[model samples]
Target: MNLSIDVTNNEGVSNVVLTGEVDAFTAPKLKDTLLPLTKEKGQVVEVDFQDVNYMDSTGLGVFISALKSTKEHASTMRLVHMQDRVYRLFKITGLTEIINIESTVQGGM
Candidate 1:
């Protein structure tokens, strides 16, 4: 499976829309697209996961890295509109405590 990323920035807000599977093979691409957006100060990165049905630990690693970058650079990162199964990974790993994740929409890709 492949991951597709679309990004847009407006008034310091970066919106990232993700589609397809986010596994080991596609995590690097997601990292590449999202990391840079979080490297700037005062940037707010909003990642929409509505169409992201599947995600592996590698994808979590990417988000972790991005989250770290956002913190180091004085930025913020958010994950929204996630599917229940995909959101479970973060919850199971206890990332929900440290990361900003919301909108667990019921359904799949």
Candidate 2:
């Protein structure tokens, strides 16, 4: 499947809305679009994963890299509105503890 990433920046925050899958084939695209935003000092990079229903380890790598970059640049990365199935990957991989993840669903965080 293909991956589509839409990014907008405002008030020192970069909002990324992702659509489609993030597997091996699409991870590079995500990395390209997200990592650059993390380079800005004290910036906030918020990614909406509500429309993304599928992802693999490669996608995790992209986020991990972005996280590391954010730390180096003093930026913040937030992943929000993720589907349960995709969120489980982060949970099982122990990333939920390190990454800031939130959901719009009631009782979710």
Model 2: weakest 10-residue lDDT segment is: 100-109
| Per-residue error (Å), model 1, residue 86 | 0.5
What do the candidate models score in CA lDDT, each in turn? 0.92, 0.93
| lDDT for each residue of candidate 1 in 4-101, tens digit (9 for 90 to 100) | 89998899999999999999999989998999999999999999998999999999999999988988999999999988889899999999999999
Question: Which stretches in model 2 have alpha-carbon errors above 4 Å?
Answer: 104-109
Task: Report lDDT (Cα) of residue 66, candidate 1.
Answer: 93
Q: Write the per-residue lDDT of candidate 2 for residues 1-109, one digit (tens) a residue.
A: 9988999989999999999999999999899899999999999999999999999999999999998999999999999999988999999999999999995585655
Pick out the ten consecutive residues of candidate 1 with the lowest summed lDDT: 100-109
